[model samples]
Target: MNLRQIEIFQAVFAAGTASKAAVLLNLSQPAVSKAVQDLERSIGFALFDRSTGRMVPTAEGELFHREVEQTFAGLSRLRSSAARIRDFGSGEIRLASLSALSTNIVPKAIAAFRQRHPQVAITFQTQMSSTIRDLVAAGQFDIGLTSDEVDATGVTVEPFAIYRAAIALPEGHPLCAKPVLSPPDLHGEAFVALAPEDRTRQKLETVLAAAGAVPRIVLETPYSTTVCAMVQAGIGCGLINPLNAEPFLGRGLTWRPFEPALYFCTLLLTPPGRRGSRIAEDARTLLMSFAGERPALPADLHHVPEG
Candidate 1:
């Protein structure tokens, strides 16, 4: 009939007597008998054959209990699921980040976050700065990190970091002879450039132009990792984020400081005016802290704290 009636009926059926059912259910014997009578009358079934001191199940009762036990099994599972949701988290924290941070800083932050919230799910996506901006603006991602080249529109933005760039060179190249490279050193040398739209690339080009130096532009790409790989392959020497250069240092790759010291600017982005889950906020915090805690370099990091 009703859930309470079903509970009482199942208890009585399992215990096989009103007094025993009352003890199991923490109810009086009379109250248990009344509930059982109500359930039988509501369903119009004779569930128990009442003997002198015991209640015996009828054929109908035995068949009815088979289905009731299955329902209770499902109820038990729902209860366990509820407990799990309370102990852990319910949803995933979605993160959109640039490839520049994906390899080093972001992965470390994710690993740290997982140690505290082991059951919480995380989704990490790597894309260009512009795509990361769009994802944060549209609320497609819980948190985002992008290069300063991304326009500060639609989403809340703040200065993230301004890290110095280094020129990645193929090992044993002639330019490696120079302790540091000036625009003149790069003159007439084959070069791998970051995408033209990058502010860092534009700055490097401007410095070269002011010095009246030109390198043979052999290739261009959007990812710093690609720049490192291309330099390792001896495709051409390129200027890239030093954070991205560490992985390729001994694999036929080396780095030199560029004259006037170019730097890459970054921005931290999030959905404006929205309070996300604790998991997301904590993830963003961990990510920023990891960036700040990286080894000292020619870098200026701006850590923004929020609730």
Candidate 2:
């Protein structure tokens, strides 16, 4: 009739006597017998053979017992799954990232995070920085990686790491021979630029404007990877984050520290009104660890020995 009644019936059936069931269930014998009787009455049949001195199940009782066994088994599994989630031993983590970081920083951090949280389901999406901020604020993403700090209405932002932006040039470009470049050195070169609204675009524009050097803007792309590829193709030279520029440095492209070293700082963004999400915090820790005390060079970066 109810879980309590079912439990009492199970105890009585297992113990083979109402007196023994009452002792096992910590209830009086009368209470156990009443519960069993109530269950049988609700089901419209006798569940046991009363004439036998030993408790024996009727055909109907055996059929009911089969269902009760299955029901209790399912309840046991449900509690176990709930416990696992509550303990943070298993769950899904959704992440979002700016296009630049999606290809470089995220993969490494995810690799490290997976080693520890192998059971956590992880999903990733890539979008522009502004989109990342909006989604994270709306609780669509547990964690977001962005190049610039995001200050949306319902999101918390934390500084993760900073890496210098450098000039990327074709291997044969004359500026590659310069030991240290100033804005004047890059003047008049055809440029491959990020979208005008991109954070790094504003920073680089300011640096170039201050030096009175206007680049010949020929190509524009939103992703850092595309800018680096164009630079490698000799389409134009541009300033880009080392993490994005380093990988293509030696493949017919050279990276040199920009004169007024424009540094790019990565920000960790999370939904507000939550103290901390296990997934977001884990992502933050993983990114910071990959960032390390020192900045990361692009994957193909090589430190040339000093002259």
Candidate 3:
């Protein structure tokens, strides 16, 4: 009938007598008997036969008890899971990030977060920086990692990491001789350029144009990983974020500091009005910590202002 009736019925069935059920449920025997009577009346069935002052369950009562037991078991499990989630942050954390960060930085942060909260689940998605920002603002994701080029109208943005651009070159390349490369040094050199639509690519183009230097553009793609791959294959040298360049090291790829530094800045994005779950906040902290541990670039390198 109702949850209370079902609970009393279950207690009576388990304990075999009204007085014993009352003791188990911390209720009076009269209250337990009245609840069971009301449940039988609501169900229009004789749940138990009273004989010799002992209650014996009818066939219908046994069948109903089976279903009630199953339902109660499910409720018990739900309560346990809810408690676990509330106390230990053991639930799904939805994370969205740019394609570049999804490769190395985000994964490293996830690994660190998992070490502390092994039961917490994670969902990671990769999209353009704008898309990541939009999804986070829409509350579709708990956290977002993107470049500073996003529109921060409906989202809260914090500086997550600052990476200086580096020159990625194939081993034995002539530019490898230079400890730090400037735009003029790369002039006329075959270059693997980022897609024109990329914000970082536009900034880099502006910097090179101001320096009166132009590289012989060989290929263009949207992904930083592809740029690293092309450089390793000797297609051309590339200026890329250091985080993207880290994994390609010692794989026929080497990185040199780029002069007149152009920073590739990443921002942490969250919904403007809502606080994130404990798990999401912990993950954000881990990501920031990982970024901080990366080798610091030169302090004297000139910073390119955000346009």
Candidate 4:
């Protein structure tokens, strides 16, 4: 039978009379009686005994009431879950990001978001820029943070932050004395470079070549954090994003701006056709705020790409 009929049956069974059921259900007595009658017709069975003035449940009615109670209980739970998701963002947010941001910036942003949306669940994955782009484009992730080098074909790319490349150095390094460094200052110095496929690495190589400066390449890595760690260990000085270099600044590591500044651009990526949930948008805004507030980077360098 229909939900309304089941509801009427349940009310009558609980209240023991159509008149009492009508008062409990906020319906007219005739409407309640008619609903019960319709339900009995639909089920091809009498659900109640009317031998006395009071309505009493039949054996079939008692069994049916049990199922109705369970059904309503399940519906109540479903509604509660839906309300939780609506009001508190209790649903999960799937996110992916580049390794550089995943290390510090993203984690800080997630912490801030959790302060506001404590019930929202988060799944964060760190991947290379291209992999982040692919995951977002394939709709596997709700939001993605990646470098501007990502292919924007099936994904929408928005600039989240920009940072000028800097020379990361260990404490007591001779180059730390320079206020602003150019590639020539690094000539013949040991260098920790990013992997060859990294766009920033290619740009650094171009700048170095143009300046006629060749640092002795000693190590190559895919992550800016690793570059910073290697620099802290005095393996070699490296060019890195200022955002990624912030956490290591006071921990026996320092950075200086590279003259004729080379820039590293970070972008937010999302599937082109999908609308992000409120929680996802909120998290993205927080991430942008964290990126904007990086004291190590210039204010003008921070930007949001056009829609």
What are the models' TM-scores?
0.80, 0.74, 0.83, 0.74
- Give the local distance difference test score of model 2: 0.79
- Once superposed on the true structure, which residue ranges of model 4 sit more than 4 Å away at CA? 1-22, 27-73, 80-92, 297-307
Candidate 2 vs candidate 4, lDDT winner:
4
**Runs off by more than 4 Å, candidate 2:** 1-77, 293-307
lDDT (10s digit) by residue, model 2, range 241-289: 7677657756888777766667777788888887555655776788888
The predicted structure with the larger lDDT, 1 or 4, is 1
Worst 10 residues of 1 by lDDT: 298-307
Model 3 steric clash total: 0
Model 1 spans with C-alpha error above 4 angstroms: 1-18, 29-90, 294-307
Ranking by TM-score: 3, 1, 4, 2
Q: Residue 188 error for model 3, in Å?
A: 2.6
lDDT of 4 at 292: 74
What's the lDDT for all of these models?
0.84, 0.79, 0.83, 0.83
Question: lDDT score, residue 157, model 2?
Answer: 84
Best by TM-score: 3
Candidate 1 per-residue C-alpha lDDT over 1-307 given as tens digits, one digit per residue, 9 for 90 to 100: 7999899989898898999999999999999999989889998998999965678899999998999999999999788667646654444688989999898989999999889887667889999899889999999998898999898789998777667787888988898777777899999999999999999999999999999999998999999999989999999999898788777777788877777878888888999888766677788788778776442332221221111
